[model samples]
Target: MADWGAIGAVKSAVNIPVIANGDIIDAPSASRALELSGADGVMIGRGAQGQPWVLAQIAAELAGQVYRGPQGHALADVILKHYEDVIRFYGPDLGVRNARKHLTWYLERLEGGMELRNLIIRERDASVVLKRLTEGLKNCGPIIEVAA
Candidate 1:
């Protein structure tokens, strides 16, 4: 939504590539948005927040290609690293707070995530959050939670 205007306007004004950013969550949406905005390419932002493979998905579909999602353990590691990055970016207090939401999301992708999410929210700081998240991983046994 945020980049629609710029994308549309740029597409209209120049022959260069006009990449639309924001709110492109899937292949249909990506194609529809480009069609609507008359843009050359789409640049997704938050839509790929937790699902990094979304970019490849869109790219593949739009480019008449196929894209497979990340592997299980590989995806888990990506998610865990994402939490660590968030903690590093936002610091322990805000980071831990932010990680809470992300952890919930990560948990949902697994089997029994609600309990783990509930347990994680109780953590007060980054270290505790990380610990709880790790514990959740170990104790909950393969729960992929996605925060709402």
Candidate 2:
């Protein structure tokens, strides 16, 4: 559990803005942190690892808006774009290696995704990994369905 009390104490004492961070995964948690800590905002860390859209979701929920999140082809495009950008930033070899963990997180919740995840982490070729990721996302289920 997060030390929300500690955050509250800090918020009361500190002159600068306090941002509560730690285990603030979803809207409810974010709301709770803010309510208890008296902070300006909450900071999401690992929760946003693969599903970066979670930020939007949390925000929408806080504002009483509906956030369905990306699905199907759109979600696939987002994942692929992220992978490609990682590859570009780090170069083929380093990029592929660094992206393995992120890809794993992205597919962790997929139904029957273990095999694809295994292949993705072990495979060295960026093209092969991208192709496999695309196919797996398409054939399995909705992006949100597979989210861990």
Locate the minimum summed-lDDT window of 10 residues in model 2: 139-148
lDDT of 1 by residue, 1-148 (tens): 4556556776778877777767788899888888778887778776775577788988898889998776556666777788899989998778888777677556666676667778777778677767666666655455343553
Write down the RMSD of all candidates, one decimal each: 3.6, 1.8
The runs of at least 3 residues in candidate 1 whose Cα sits more than 4 Å from the true structure, single-residue gaps closed, are: 1-10, 14-17, 138-148
Maximum-lDDT candidate:
2
Residue-level lDDT of model 2, residues 7-80, one tens digit each, is: 99998887999999898989999999999899999999899987899999999999999897787788879888
Candidate that would win on TM-score: 2
Relative to the unseen true structure, what is the C-alpha lDDT of residue 84 in candidate 1, on a scale of 0 to 100?
92
lDDT score at residue 1, model 2, on the 0-100 scale:
88
Error of 1 at 143 (Å): 8.8
TM-score of 1: 0.73
